[model samples]
Target: MNKRPSILIVDDEVSNIEILSAVLEEDHDIYFATSGDEAIATARAALPDLILLDVLMPGTDGYEVCTSLKGDPLLADVPVIFTTALGDQEAEVKGLELGAIDYIAKPISPVVVRARVRNHLEMKRMRDDLAKLAVTDALTGLGNRRRLEQALNIETARLALTSGTLSVIILDIDFFKRFNDLYGHTAGDRCLTMVAAALNRAVHHASDLTIRYGGEEFACVLPETEHDRAMDIAHGIRERVEALNIPHSGSDVAATVSVSIGVATAACVPGATPEAWVKAADAELYKAKAAGRNSVSGRTFQVVVEDARPLSSTA
Candidate 1:
């Protein structure tokens, strides 16, 4: 709320647009796009904090534009307001039903327009920041366990609805305890950071959440990604870390950093709980360690990490 925000005013009539812009300029970074299409394009480009749209226009009107904006994944969160002279109860109801956050009757007062827009923008900023903190792990700046669980729940539900396929991969740095014992905890911290970056890059899909799974381990929650594809991503992370060539006491690559990975995937189908999905991936990670070290193992392969143990949830 303290930061300056960009606001877009969409109207076909030049005078109405100018008046609204003049009213809002001192409070926000204002942009005007006369047509519905132009407004949507500008909204997307600017990622504006708020949108003031005209209900009646020559071609595409505000309702259609609002629906389209709501349908898009990236633009849906930006709040929209219908600004029109149509004061009927039905018109206001329709505008609200079209996913606009508010409707402002035309013959607009600068005070009303500025006040409502500012209030909604403040709410949007607060909501966004709060949602971010809920999803992020404060310690590592990665997705926390709660966020991971939420992502899995949502993804699993979508898969059932859409019949898509996805994979989850779990990885652990082999013999991390002994390495920490030798090089100290600070070096271990550096290793974790490097692996996190590698995982973030290796998983190219925007839907994927690279999570720090507590300590000495991580998980990649990948959607629309299958088993072979998941293994490919895992191998990519493994190879990249090996290339870093950090010396570790007991790893195959030099000595510093080698990771054992386990990947599990499920199709958009019934009978797959998120817990069961991760259990499969966890089993595979242990197999990688048992088969030796410095490798990527899938649910099909049987490898085991030394002192490998399944983690139980405190919840």
Candidate 2:
């Protein structure tokens, strides 16, 4: 069954809240707040599909609330409609400029409110679907490179503030090109899918993210993890891929499928950036590949100075 969308109604007047709630409650899970602060809190907590905002309020008026919501990363995507009694053209223009998707002037009509809410909700659903498609890999059903980079940036920033550790593991299928040449691209694609699934299964932590990092390589972002734990996870990934027993006749290393992994961890400092972390991991990956294909190599580094310069690995 399709779940009903949620809507947040923010108004300072009791009658306004009650009327809107009565209209929208039948179709949506309704949440209401009588003040701007309460509205912001409720919207953040509930993450409603849409917001019905009143422009005139005592404190943190509707315009201020809308601006706040648009500024927040978590709430930025939610659509907002101004439900104001101020029917002037200037008022509507200001609300739209402040990031409201639509403005509906009151004395409220239940039918108009219902239709506008439904239309906006449908539009939101489509936009969300398209956004997901943009960040997801169609072949392996893992996150694509764009998503990986975004996640890496977010994690790195988070760890910098907390002085926590973040690790990245880069895994490449051993002799993947040879496999594709010998077995045909169809089989090679199947191999990638299998390997992607194995890597996804090996990292069980909710905070860990696995992504398809371009052709023949995959990446795992592990936040708040240490070097030893990252190595263990890397080894587990190698073992899982091998256990799949996919025949690799072109390879000299093993009779079946195998992978090489490089792991890099950062004890994040103020200046640390996502690119440096990935570069460090890529360097380790080069070492692993050079050491002869099917193996795991890992190192740890710390950010130095305020510039976020990376120091040579202490590992």
Candidate 3:
């Protein structure tokens, strides 16, 4: 069963908060904030799906609160509805300009409030679903290359500030073309899905992300992980893929489906970029292919060198 969507009712008046809560509590998980500051804090903590905001609260009014919420990257996408007595055109325009999805005038009608809330919540759910689909791979259900690059960039910046380490593993199916040609494209897609699932299972950490990096290739981003552990994870992925037992008679590497993995680990440093990290992993992948398929190659860098120099394998 789906969990109830959460809503935050922000109003200074206890009576108003209670009324909105009673209206929404049956269908939604409801939270109350008596002031704008409290509302902001609660929204950040709870990340409610929808907010019902009163316009005339003391200290920080609904307009200011909505602005703050819209400015926040984490909270910006959350839908906000202004529940206020000021039903004038100017007030509604200002609220909309500040990123509110709807404006509800007081004295509130329970039925209208309920219907609008349901409609807005449903719309938000659809929007969220679409956004997720945009970044997700359709065949493998893993994050797509764009999503992986975005995550890599964000992690690189974060670790740069903390002087931490980040690792990447790039892997591809051995003799995938021959497998596809022999088994047909349909079977090839199934094999790719199976490999993606194995890679996903092998990562095992919430902080790690597995992504489908285009056709027949996948990548894993391991944040705050060092060289040895990264290599272990890569090898584990290789073992898992081989154990899938998907037959690949066209390949010479193994009787069953197998993969080659390349691992690159680096400490965050000046001039480090996500592209360079990926290139390092790609180079290691080249080495893995050179050494023969169904193997893992890895390298660790102390700091990012901006000279575009070739990276040597540490293992």
Against the true structure, whose TM-score is highest? 2
lDDT of each: 0.80, 0.89, 0.88
Each prediction's RMSD to truth: 8.4, 5.2, 6.0
Task: Give the CA lDDT, 0 to 100, for residue 298 in model 2.
Answer: 89
Writing each residue's lDDT as its tens digit, candidate 3 over 109-192 gives 999999999999999999989988988999999998878866776677557767889999999899999999999999999999
Model 2 CA deviation exceeding 4 Å by range: 1-4, 12-19, 30-46, 153-167, 203-208, 222-233, 264-272, 290-292, 298-315
Candidate 3 whole-model C-alpha lDDT, 0 to 1: 0.88
Best-to-worst lDDT order: 2, 3, 1
lDDT for residue 250 in candidate 3, whole number 0-100: 89
lDDT of 1 by residue, 149-180 (tens): 76676676556556677688899988888888
Q: lDDT of model 2 at residue 38?
A: 99
Model 2, span 32-117: residue lDDT tens: 99999999989867989999999999989999999999976558889999988777899899889989999888999999999999
